[model samples]
Structures are given as structure tokens and as C-alpha cells.
Target: MHRRSAVTVAVAAALALLVATLTVLTGAYEITPGGVVSTLFGGGSGTDRFIVWEQRLPRAVAALLVGVALGGCGAVFQSVARNPLGSPDIVGFTTGAASGGLVMILVVGSAGSQSVLVGTVAGGALAAVTVVLFTLRRGLGGDRLVLSGIAVGAMLAALNDYLISRAPIEAAETAKAWQYGSLNAIGWRPVVPLAVSLALAVPVTLALARSLRALELGDDAAAGIGLGVTATRVTALAVGVFLAGAAIATAGPIGFLALAAPQLAGRLSRAPGIALGPSMAVGALLLAVADLLAQRLLSPFQIPVGLLTAAVGGAYLVWLLTRAPRREGARGAR
Candidate 1:
């Protein structure tokens, strides 16, 4: 709770709120400003009620919560790995989860179902196991794990595309929407499981933040200080895998939020290392805005929010690579 961290949280909260408000106000079926307020409080025309309560409100809430989960886990992975590049996307969890959900969507033909969620989490777990098996050949090092994840992720990406190509035309189109990280088909029904999962995961991650700090001192130092290095790492890996799986299950691989949120949060909060609170808030802010942009950019034709974030993240990646100190490359790649 540094003052800078507090300030960053407040600012991100404000931006998230503003984005939510704008999202409600903007859409295909326009509702007047006063109408939106009245509708929110249980008094408006049927159209306004349906659009606001039944539609936009749930979508906005889902986006916010998903961002929170992604952002929180992003901080966990980055801090645990001791490098900013140590995110779920880079670690292969996202690709695994996506591959699972894609299979459900294409082969099983369940786009947004509880079964699809199960498949995703299961796929992600398997992918995580595979990466760990490969990396654990020598020892559990973040660099080795990341390298394994990248390779696994590339293979999974191909699998995902192949599945899509083999799908029926209609199913292909349906899976295509999910693949883009679009929230077009989401409703309040699916939000329950997602919200519940995030609620369960958040407190655990927050509790582990202190252990993460100690672990940042390296395994020997952490163990000397009486922290259970193995258990801590295992718990963190579980948390990151679960978070990334839930996110992918809900939104289908919304890239770069995991990659960018923690680093940006660290800079904004002026944290000694990485901070989870600011990262969650920043993630909510980024997603809220991205979802808004996704709706507005194509107007009648909504683009996927993932596309927008990927574009933004790509630019940020370029800046990061260019601005990073040369010596850090060896350390980061490790």
C-alpha cells in the first residue's frame, strides 16, 4: 500500500468506471443517458432494460472481472519467474487453454458451455504438465520453463488452426469468433462460473504475494529464510495455470494483458518489485477500454477485443525491446 500504488489503483479504478459507463451508453440500440440510469435502478422501457441490464451490464462486469484475474495472475507469473516476460501467454498455458476450448467449440460444438470450460481447464493443465516435464529434466528454472512453453505454444497454435480448418463452415465461423477473443455471444449465464472461479483465486494470489517477494531473492535465499521454495513455486504454478485457463475459457486468448499488465503496474506503482493490486486495476482498465474499442471501431461490425489488444501489445512490445538494456537480455532470456 505505497502511496504511489494507492494513487495508481485509484486512477485505474476511475478509468475502469468511466469505460464501463461509456460501454453502457454506447451500443447498437442506443439508450439516452437518463434512460440508462433509470434502467439501472429497475425503471425504464423494456428496450432499455433489456439492453442495459440483460446485455451491456453483464458484459462489462465480465470484462472487468476477467481482466482482474488475468492481471492478478500476470503479476504472479512475472514475479515468480523473476522476469517481465514470464506471462501465461509466453508460458504456453494460454495456447493450451485455447486449444482445449477450440476443440470444444469445433469438435464438441459447445461454444460457451460448462463442458467447454472443463475442456479448457483440462487442456491447460495438460499443457502445463508437459512444459514442466520438459523443463524439469535438469531442474525447474524459469528460463527453461519459458522456452518449453514457447515451443509448446507454437505447436498448439498450429493445432488450433488445423482444428478450425477441419471444422464445418458454420462451426468454423462460430469458433472463429471465440478465437478472436470477442465477447459478442456472451451473456450473464456464463458469467457465473467465471466470476466464481476468479473470486476463489484472487484471495489466494493476494496471500501469496509476500511469499513471492521472498522467493524473488532466489531459491537458496528463500529457503534460508524458511520459506518453502518448492511448495511456493508449485502453488504459484497452479494459481497461474488456473487463472490463465479461466481467462481463456471465458474470452479465448486475450493476448498481451498478461504480458503487459504487470510491468506497467510495476512502473505505475513504483513498486520495489511487482505488485498485484495495481496490476489488477491496470488490467481492468486496459480490458474495459479494449472492449469498448472493439465495439465501436467496427460499429455495425464489431472487431474482436483481442485483436485490438494484440495490436496495442505489439506496439508496446517493440518499445520494450528497443528500450530494454542490452545486458538484461541475457538475464531475461534465462
Candidate 2:
């Protein structure tokens, strides 16, 4: 198992590197990998150097950071919720974060990164807390919790739409870009906060990986083995919120990567529980690939990265619903 795990990690790392390379090399003014490397290292023509270093590099880095944050957060949530269906995308955390972002952009007229990050974190954290509090009475188990999360997500989405409707035409147009998610206007400005947040949160996530494993057991069983169920759940939720909020702040709630990456990692790892390392890797790879497609698919008129992810993620969700087993638990939790 250790050897297999190591091999999986190696393969994921290689894939992430390959995807990053492709993203850098396949843009409009193509450059060889060596040229890309030299341009990044300050040894190329003015335009080539500027495009490589100033334009694409930051976007690539943003994609990688967003991927890691989403993937890691997804694994944490899925484990704590003890449902394969549990994810920010499924439970309304992403929607809440996006709503928070829209509020900052439309109502407050603040498009600053810190303002958006603060609002997004607050929104996502509140949503997570609400989900846990409302669903805990009958115990967090199976499809009931997932169903409640879905309902909350839908409500938050409706709220998002209402806010969009009330805004002025200009604000509404700006919010539309956010709603679909995009990496176009992003630069190094937003990257700093996301890097800091990920630096702090990633360590916490790795340290808690074992606890997340225990969480996959029911709360009672986890408590029996000396885990503080409430504390662990809250800590994990906080990490997830931080990650989702940061990603939304930086990249405008890129859809489905968070939901799909962790599940894909778990399957690839063949682990009984969530796999954080692999999930982060897969998430990074997915975003890199998605961004590559978004940039190249329409030439001068690029598609929003969020739209590409949603299309892929939405299709994956449909496939999941068809494959998911019917639950035998109580319909709604008290």
C-alpha cells in the first residue's frame, strides 16, 4: 500500500507538471518549453518575455493555487460529512462564497481583493456552520445530510440571482463574470493572499489528515476512539471555508473542481477514506487542464474558466446521481 501510494503521488506530480507546461507553451504566440523557461528567467525578447512572465505566469500560478485549495477542501468536507456527495459545490459553500463576493462587488462597490476575500470567507464559514448545526440533531449520516446541503445550496443560489437582479447594469455585468468564474483579469495582486492562506491552511490540513480519516467513522465511533467529534468537525470545516473563500476571492468560485477532484483522488488512490495529497494534486491538474482549454478553445475570445469547469463538473454530477445508491435512512433530519 505504501509503495502504491508513493507511485500514485509520483504520477500525479508528473501530470501536474505536464499540464502546467502545456498551459504555458500552447498560448497564441507559441514558445518552445525552453523559450518559455528562458523568458521566465529573463533572457528573451521584450514582448515574449512580458507575455510569458507578466501575463501567463501569474494566471498559471493562480490556477495551481486554486486547484490545491479546492481539492484539499473537498477531501476534508467529504471525509467529515461521511458522504461521497458532500462537497462545497453540493452543500452551498461555493454559492454562499459567490454570494458574498457579489455583495462586495454590487452592493458595497468594493472590488478589492481583501474585501472580497473577507466577505467570501465569512459567507462560506457561515454556510458551513449552518449546515453542521441544522444537520447534527439526527446525527450526520448518509443522504439526509447531503439533501439538506443541496437545499441550502439552492436557496443561496436564488439569493445570488436576486442580488444580481437588483444591481445596476454595470454591476450586474461585472457580477456575471464572477458568477461564471474567470481567470482573465487576475494578476499577482490577488495571488499574495491566496498563497498566504494556502500556506497556513495546507499544513493544518495535512496535520489533520489522520483525524479526517477517523471522521469517516460515525461521530460516536470516532469519539469512542478519543477524537473530539465537534472540534474536529469544526476545524475541518474552517479549513474548507478558508480554501473555498480564498479560491472564490482570487478566481470567482470556479465550479466543480472542488467537488470532482477529491472524489477522483479517492478513486485513484483506492483508499477507504479521503486522500488529501492526491486530491490536491488532481485538483491542480484539473484546473490547469481546464484553464488550458478555456484559453485555447476560442482564440482571441476566451471562455470563462468557471464555465468550462461547470460544464465538466455538471456532467460528472449527473453521472454520480445515476450511480449513487438509494438511502435507507430517515427522510429529513430533525
The per-candidate count of clashes, in order, stands at 1, 0
Candidate 2 local lDDT, 58-102, one digit each (tens): 888898889999999988878877877788888888888988888
Candidate 2 ranges with C-alpha deviation above 4 Å: 30-34, 326-334
TM-scores, in order shown?
A: 0.94, 0.93
Clashing pairs in 1: 143-334
Candidate 2 displacement at residue 57 in angstroms: 0.5
Among these predictions, the greatest TM-score belongs to 1
> What digit string (tens of lDDT, one per residue) describes model 1 on residues 1-334?
7789889999998899899888987788867888899889998988889889888998898788888888988898887767677788888888898899988888877766577778888888888889878977654556787788889989999999999999989899878888788776578877888899888988898889889888888889899999998788778888888888888777778998888988898988997756888999999999998998889888878888899989999888788878768657778988
Instruction: List residue ranges in candidate 1 displaced over 4 A.
Output: 326-334
